[model samples]
Target: MTKHERGALSANAPKSGEADLETRLSRLRAALDGRAPRLDAPFPAVTLIFSVSDGAARAVTAQGSGATVDAAWEVAVTDLHRKMGRRKLRGRFLRLDWVEKAETWTWALLRKRLREVKRNYSRRGIALEKGFTHLFLEQELNGNAMLYGGNQISHCVVNEKNFLIYAQQKYGSGITVDFADDREVHVFDTAGLFCGEDGVLHELYGAGRNAGRRKIDPLDVDTLRGIIGDASDFLAHQVGADGRFIYGYHPCFDRQIPAYNALRHASTTYSMLEAWELTREPGLLAAIERALEYLCRQFIRTAGDDMAFVVDTGDEIKLGANATAILAMSKYASLMGTDRYAGIMENLACGILHMQAEDGSFTHVLTWPDLAVKERFRIVYYEGEAAFALMRLYSLSKDERWIAAVEKAFGHFIEKDYWKHHDHWLSYCTNELTLYRPEMRYFRFGIRNFEGFLDFVLQRITTFPTLLELMMAGRKMLDRLKAMPEGAELLAGVDEAKFEQALHFRASYLLNGHFWPEYAMFCRNPDRILGSFFIRHHAFRVRIDDVEHYLSGLVAYADYIEAVAGSSDGAVRA
Candidate 1:
C-alpha cells in the first residue's frame, strides 16, 4: 500500500521540485570531492538511516553534522558506509536536522538547549505518555519539530511549553515515533529526505509534503466519508464481547491508558451511532448495541426514584456523565425506531433536572444512591453538556418542561455571558433549541460563541476535534440566519468569509493527527490502533474521548456537506 501523507509548511520550507533536490545534492557531492563549486549559501546536511535485523535485531540510524558540506558529509557518509559492513541498508534516507553557519546563538545557550533536549527524552511523555502539558515530548515524524544543537531552530515547532531557550524552550522529543518498525525516525529539522530507488534517488519527504505521500483532503465528501467509515470501524473494533472499549493507548510504547471515564464511554457510543447514520455497517451496529448495553448495565443507577443518574465507578454522579448517557440512549431510540431506553432516558433526564437550580446552573457533581450534592462545579463543560442533553431528550419526548428548563438555564447563560467559553455542547444546544424557538436572542447568543473563536481554532496545532464540532454547529446557526428575512441586517458584523475559511481549515487540520495506516503501522499493534485520532502534542495519546469528538465532528461535517453540497435528501439521520 502507498503511504498517505499531509502537506505542511515550515520556516524556510524546502523547495518543491525533484530537479532542485538533485542540484542541491550534486553541489554537496562536488563540495565533498574537493571540486568545491561556488557555494553562495549554507549547504544542507545529508543523513542516512538504516534498519538492523541482525542477531540482537535492532534499528540503527546514523546522524551527523559539521561546519561545512564536506565536513558534515564525511561524518554522515562515513558512518553510513561503516554501518553497511554487516547490516543491510533498510532504506537510504536523508533528513539532515543541523545546517552549518545557521546559528547566531551563544555556545553556552546551545549547550544548555541540547542538554535539556536529552533531559526531555527520558521524561514522562515517552515513559508515561503524559506530563501535565508542560514537559511532554510529542513524538512526530516532522524534522523541524526539535531543538537539537540549536541549529535551524524555529520556535513555533517547539513541543509543550517547557523549552527554556525562548522564555521556555518548549520543543519536545525530536524522535519520530511513527517510522516503520523496520525504518528509523527523521526529526528535529524542517525538511530534506530522498530515498534511493532503482539506482535513482527519489524524494521521500520534502517541506511541501510529509514522508513520501500527498495530502488527504478532509473537505471532499468522498474522502470525508471514507475517513468516517474507517474511524467507525476503528471504534467498533475497540468494543469487546463484554462491550467495554479498549480505552486508549500511549502509542510510544503501545501501552493502554490506565483509567476509564463513564461519560466518555457514553459519548463514544453516541458518536458511533452518529456515524452509523451515514455508514450503516452491520458490524458497526452490533458494536454500537454492545456498547449501549454496556453503558446501561455498567453505568446507569437504577435505584433512584423515577430519576436515575449515571453513577461512575467511584459512586459519583456528574452532570456531564448523565447528560452523555441520555444522549446515547436518545440516539439509540431514534436510530432503531424503538423506545427501548425511553423509561431509562426519562429517569436520566429527570436526574439531570434535579441537579439544576432555580437560577439555572447545574450542581456539577452529586453523591450517588442518596443523590446528595457533592460540589457546585467541577468543570465548565458540564454546563453545556447538561443543556444539550435536555434539548436532545426534548426532541424525543417533546416535553415542555425540558425546553422550559433549558430556557431557564439559558437565562443564566445569557445573563452571565456563558457563550464566551465557546463550548461545543452549547453550540449544539443552541442549534437544537432554535429549531423550536428560533428567537433572535438565542441566535445572537449562539453566533457570539464563534465570533472571535474562529481565529483561535484556525491557529491551534493540536487536532482538537471539538473545535470543528463547534464550528459545524455554528455553521448551521449561520445557515439558519441567512435563510431568515432579517439575517442580512445581522450579517454585517459577522465576517462570514473568515468564519468559512476557519471552518474549512480546522476540518482539514484535524486530519494531521489521525492514525492513518501509513503512520499507525509503526505502532506495536497496527490493527488495534489504526484510524483513531491522536493529540500529537501529547505524545499521540489515543483515548475514547479523542475518537468520540473526532467521529462526532466528522460525521456532522459530512452531513453538512450532504445538505448544502447538493443532496436531494438533506435530513441527517438519527
Candidate 2:
C-alpha cells in the first residue's frame, strides 16, 4: 500500500479516550524534558510542536492525531512555522509515531524492502545496483512497506536510470517523489525504516527526523568577513590581465556565459574599488587599475561635439553605463589623488546631463556608433544612477552645475513617485545627496522611502522562503534603519514589535546570505571553480550586478557599523 493510503487509514482509526490522550501527552513531555520514556511502549500517536531557543528545546503545544507523524511534521514545519515570527530562532514540529519494534526488526525489514524495490526497478530495465547506496523505508500496520533509495552524492539516484518512474511503477499509484537532479528526492515511507548504504541509518534517521528542529547559529560577523574576502578574491582572480571580468556564469552547467553588460561592468569595477578601500588588498587594487584601463581604453566614446560618454564595448551607449562610469572614474581619481580621469569624468557627466530632460529624467539609452537616441522611456534604476553620478562629480569638482542638475532631477524623481518602489539605488543616491546638500526635504523623502522599504519588508518577511531574499531585503534597509532617529515615529503605522522583529530577522539573515553564494560555486573544475551570486527565485542565473550589489551592500553596512562604534547613540549619523 502507498504511504498516503496508509496515512489515510491511520487518520480514520479510532482515537483513544481523553485519559489515554493525557497519558500520551505526559509521555511526550517527558521525552522532551530529557527524561527517557518507554521507547518500546505503544502510545497514542501525537504531534508535538517545539520551540527551540538559546540551545533549549521545549514542547510548546501538542495535538492528538492518528495520522502519520511525518505528514504532521511536514505541516507543522511548513504551515505552522509560516504563521510564527520568522525571527523566532527555531520553531519545529515533531511526530512521535506509536510503534513497538523488536531489536533490529525495523532496520532489517527496511533493508529487505529496499532490495525488493531495487530488483523491481532492475526488472524494468533500469539498473539500481550501482547507485543504491541508501534506503528510507516506512511500513503500515497492514505489513505494507514503502521504499526510497539514494546515491553517494546525497542524491536519491538508485542507479544511472529514471528512479522516479521506477518508484511509481513498483510502488503503485499515490507514490509521490519530488526529485531535484538525482541528488535529492522527497519520498514517503512508514515501518519506521530509514537507512543509508554508509551503514549510518540510525544516525541519518536521528538527524533527518529532527531536521526542522535544528538550530541556526546567530549571524557571525567573522564569517561574513570571510565570505566578503572570498568574494573579493573571486572578483580579483576573475579579472583578465586586460581588466575585463568574467561577466556571466551558469553554475548548473559550470560554463561561462559569453556575454557582457557595460553598466554591470562599471558597477562591478566600482565594487572592486570599494573592496580595495576596505581590505587594502594589493591584488584588488591591481585588478581595479586593470579594469580602469579597460574602461577608459575601450568604453569611453566621443559623441557629437566631442561630448564623451562611456558605452559598452560592443553594445549600446546606455545612460546607466555613463552614470556608473562617472562614479567609478571619480572614485578612482580620488583613490589616486590625481585628475587623471577628470576630463573623462566631466565628459561622461556632460553626456548624461545633455541627455537629461529639462524636468530632470535622463534618456535611457543611445545607439553607440551613430549617437542616436535608442531608448527614451524611463527604466527602473537609470535615473537614480544618473543623479548619483552627477552628485559624485559635484563632490569631486565642487561644480554647481552638477548640483543644479541633481536638484532638478530630485524634483522630477519625487513627482514620479520613485519612492514607492523598492529601488535601493534611489535610496542610496538620496542618502548621499542628503549628506552633500542636507536639505530637510531630502531627509524627509529619504526617511519616507525607507519607511516604504520597511513596510515592504514587513509585508514580505513571513512570505520569504529563502534566506537570500531575507538578506537582500535586510541589506537594502540596514543603513537607513541605522541612520533613522532611534524611537522616531517612522513607518508611522508599523508597531515597535514588527520593527524590532525586522531588525532581529535581518541580523539572522546576514550570516545566511553571506554564505549562500558558496552554493553557486561550480564543482566540476576545482581550479576554475568560483562563486557566483545568483537570483534565487529565478533559474539561479548568475549576473555581474548580483555580485556588485551584494558586495556594495556588505561594505556599506560594515562602514556604517564602524562609523557608529564610538558614538554614544551607537546609531549611524545622518
Candidate 3:
C-alpha cells in the first residue's frame, strides 16, 4: 500500500474477526520460529502484547488455517511501523481490540523510542525532543510540563528527533545527547540556568536574556519598600529628558505603541509620590517632579472662558484627566508642605466641577480648545473620582465650596449605587469620605461594596481559567485587603480573623506565581520596561494605566500593612 493509504489505516485497530485466539497464536509462533517471512518494516519495530485481565500464561500449540485473518493483523502492524517512520504522531497514542467474544488481548507499546529524550552531561541536565533542547523545565499550576529552549518552548508534549535538531541548531556543537526516553522528564540546564539570590529561577527575556525576576517578600516592609523603590526607578527610566513618559508597549513584538493618556500620567505621578513618601528615594522624587512638570506643560489646556483643564495632547479633554491631575497635584502640595501647585490644582478642580451636571454626574469628555462636550454620556468612574478630588481639595484648602460639592456629588453617587460596578475608586472615595464625615450609612456602603468585590475575587480565584484572570484577581484581593480594615467591624457575616488569613493566603499565591511564571510575561525592553497587558483575551497592548493601577494598588496595600504592624495596640484603626 501507498504511504498515505498506510498512514490512514494506522489509526484502525485489528478487528475481532481478523485473528482468533488459536489463529493469532499460530501466526505468532510461525513469526517467532522464522516460518513466516520477516516483514520489510519501514522503521525499527518494538511491539508489546498483554492481556487486560489477569490470566495464566500458556504456550500456544494449536495450528490454525485462517490465512486471511492472520495476514490482516500483520498488515496492521506493518502499517503502524510505516506511520511511526514518517513521524505522524505528535502526542501520546493508545489502541484496544477484542479478539474473541469472551476474551480480549491488550497491547501497550511505545512506537517512537525517542519521543522525549532525557540525558545527563557532566552533572548538567538536558531534555531533547523534536529538534528543541530544553534548558529549563517547569510544571504549570495545572500539572502540565513546560520545556523552555533558548528560542522557544513547548507545553505538555515533546517530540524527539525534531527537538534534538532544533537544539543543536540553536546551541551549536556543544549540544550532546547521550540517551533517549519514552517518558517525559524534567531536565535542568546547569550551564544556562539562572537562580536568584533567593534560590528561585530567574526569568529571562530578549537577546541579552536579562534576568527579569525581582525578588521581594510581599509581607516584609523592607521588601515592599525595595519594590516601590525599584518600580520608581523603572518609571524614572521611562521618562524622557523632554518629560514625556513612555506610554504604550507591546511585549510580544518588543516594540512601543505610540499613544499617550493624561489621566494615566497623573495617576502614575501620584503612585511615584507614594513611593517617594515610603522610601524618600531621591531618584523617585526627581522622576515625580519631571512627570508633574510634563502634566503641567503638555496636558493642561484653557478654554475660551479661561477655564483650564488637563487634556491629552491638545484637544481631547477627559473629566478623569482633570480629576486625576487635581488629586496628584494636591498630594504633591501636601507632601511638600508648600502650595507650589495649589493654583493649578484649583483650576483643574474647577474644570471638573464645571463638567458636573446638576444631578452630580460629570460629562465624561470634551473637545479642548473650544470646550465643547465630546461625550455627554455618564461612565461609572469619573463622577466618584471627581468627588474624591473635591474632597481632597477641601481637606487641603478647607474650601467650603469643595466640601459642599462633594456632599452633593457623593449623595448622588450612593443614590445611584455606582459602586455596584467594578469601580475601586468609588470604594476608595467612599472609604475616605466615611473617615472624614463618619456617617454610618457611608461606612456601611463602603463595607457592602468591598464585600461585593471580595465575592467577585473569590469567584475569579475558584474559576481562574486564564493567566490574566489570575493576575487581576490577585490584584483585586490586595485591594480588598487594603480597604477591609477600614470597615472590618462593619462587615456582616465575616470573621475578621479568617478574612485576614484568607487575604494573606491569596497574597502568597499571587506573589509566588508572579515571582516565577508571570514575571516572564512583562516586557523587559527599556522602552516597554515593566509594562503588562490588559487581559490575556485582549490585544497584547500595554497601556500606562495598567502599570499605574498595579503600582498604586500594591504600594497602598503595603503601606497599610506596615502601618498596621507599627500600631501599639496591634489593632486596625478605623
Candidate 4:
C-alpha cells in the first residue's frame, strides 16, 4: 500500500501476475514520466566558439575596416611589379595541375625552375628581392607554438622555401621577399594594431595568457608575421613526401582520429586562410578541395560504432573520444557540403541520442559493453561535450532538428542539476557544455555555480544508495531470482534476463561516469592528474581550461537532497 511496499512488490511480481506487475510497471513508468521539476532559476554564462569560415565569408559580417593585410600587400606587390616593369611575372597560383605536375615531375625539373627564378630576383636587386623574401620568409617563419610545440619552427622553415620557389616561378623575381624570427625583428600593423582582447594580434600573435601557459604573452608584430607565414606555407603545400604540413598533422580531433597530426596539417591548409596572413596562394583553392575530400573520407570511415577512430575499443576510453570524432565528422560534412552527408550524419546523431539515460547522464564504454544499464548511470562528461558539438551543428546548418536535439540532450545538465558542483572535474565538464548554449538560456548552465554542482552529486551519493550500491543491490536481487528452481523458465516469462541487461549498462555507466578529480585538464601540474592512466593530465590541459573560480557547490547539495526524498531510495533506504 505504501510507496516503499509498492516499489518492492513491483519488482517481484510475476509477468503473468497482472495486478502486481501492472502496479510495479506503472510506478516505474510514472517515476520516469513525472514532471522533472527544476527548482532554482537565474542567468548564466553563454559558452560556444563560433565555427570557422573564410575571410571573404566572415568579412561580410566582420566589423572593422574590412581590410586584410594580404589584400593590402597584394596591391603593394602589383604596384612594385609595375615599377619594375615585371608586372606579368608574378607566381602562377599553384593549381591542381601544378600539384599533379610536381607529383609526377622529378626533383631535377623542380630544381631547374627554382634556379631560373633566383636568377631573375638577383638581377632585380632589393626591390624584387624584398617582395620575394618578405612573402616567402613570412610563410617559412610563422608557427603556432601551442599546436606544434617546439616543432613549429622547423615546420615553418620547410614550407617557406617551397613557397618561395613556387612564387619565383610564377611571379618574375621582380618582388622582394625575406623572413626572420618575428621576435628578433620589428613589424607594424598598417591599420594600427588592436589592443582589445580579441584583436588580430591577440589571436594571431599569441597575445593574452597562453591557455597553454598560464602567463599572457603579448603578440609581437614579428611573431605574428612568422606565424602567418608558417601557417600559410603549412596549409598550402605538402612539406614533404608524406603529403603533410610542417608538423605533419591534421587539425581535426587533435587527439581522437588516427593520424590527427597529419590530418591537422591538411585541415589547416584550408581552414587557416582567414587567420594566417597570405594572399590566395596559386594552389590554395585546389588544395581546399582536396583537403575536404580527404576529410570526408576520414569522417565516414572512423566516426561510428565500427569506425577506424581513436578509442574504437576498450583501449582508449577517455572522456571525449567517440563524441569528438562524431563532432568532427559533422563539422567537416557541413563545411564540405551537406547534400552528400545529411543522412549519414542524422543516423550518427540518432545513435548517440539512444544512449541517454532517465537521469540525463551518459555512459562511456569503460564499464558497460554498450547497452548495459544495470547500475545507476554515472555522468559522462562527453554527454555535455557532445551537446556542444550538436549545438554547433545547429549553428552551421540552422536545422531545427539539430537545435531541438541539442536543447533536449543538453538540457540534461539542468535536469540532473549536474553543473552546480565545484571541482576541476566539474569545471572542465561544464565549461564545454555551457559554451555552446545561447547566453543564459539553460537552467543548469545558467551561471557559474560549479561548487554547487559537485556538492549536489556527492550529497546524493551520501544521502541515498549511491550509484554503485544500487547496481550491487539490483544485481544481487537478479542473481537470487536466477537461482530459483525453474528460475530460467520463470524469467523467460518476465524477461528477467532482459531486465538484467541494465546491470551491464550500470557498470558501464560507472566506468564512464564523470568525476571531477583535478586530473581532467593538465598533466604538468601535479594537482591536475587523477588516478586513471587512460586519462593523461597532458591531454586534459591541452584540450580545455580551468574555470574553478566561478562555481557553486551549494546548488549541487540542494539537488542531492531532493533526489533522496523523491526516488525509490526514499522508501527502500529510509
Candidate with maximal lDDT: 1
Worst 10 residues of 2 by lDDT: 195-204
Q: Which stretches of candidate 4 lie over 4 Å from their true place?
A: 1-322, 329-338, 366-381, 397-400, 415-446, 449-574
Best by TM-score: 1
* lDDT per residue as tens, model 1, 1-574: 1122122212223334233334434533532343222222232332222222221221233444444545666676666556655465433222222211122233344334445443212111111111111212122222112332222442222332223322122223443222123332212222233222111222222232133222443246666777788888988998999899999887645779878889999999999999998989999999999998998888887654678888896888999999999899899898888999999988888888899999998899998778788889999899898899999899999999899999999999999999889999999999999999998889999999899887898777556789999999999998889899877667777998888888878777777667754345334455566678776545557888888899898888887767676654332221
TM-score per prediction, in order, is: 0.72, 0.60, 0.59, 0.31
lDDT of 4 at 534: 22
lDDT tens per residue, model 3, 375-412: 88657677767877887888899888787787778777
Ranking by lDDT: 1, 2, 3, 4
RMSD of each: 10.2, 16.0, 19.8, 27.9
Instruction: Tell me the RMSD of model 2 versus the true structure.
Output: 16.0
Residue 555 displacement (Å), model 3: 1.7
Name the runs in model 1 displaced over 4 angstroms.
Answer: 1-213, 521-527, 566-574
Order of quality (TM-score): 1, 2, 3, 4
- Output the lDDT of residue 308, model 1: 86
Residue 86 C-alpha lDDT in model 1: 40
Cα lDDT for residue 224, model 4? Answer: 23
Of candidates 4 and 2, the better by TM-score? 2
What C-alpha lDDT values do all the predictions have?
A: 0.64, 0.51, 0.48, 0.30
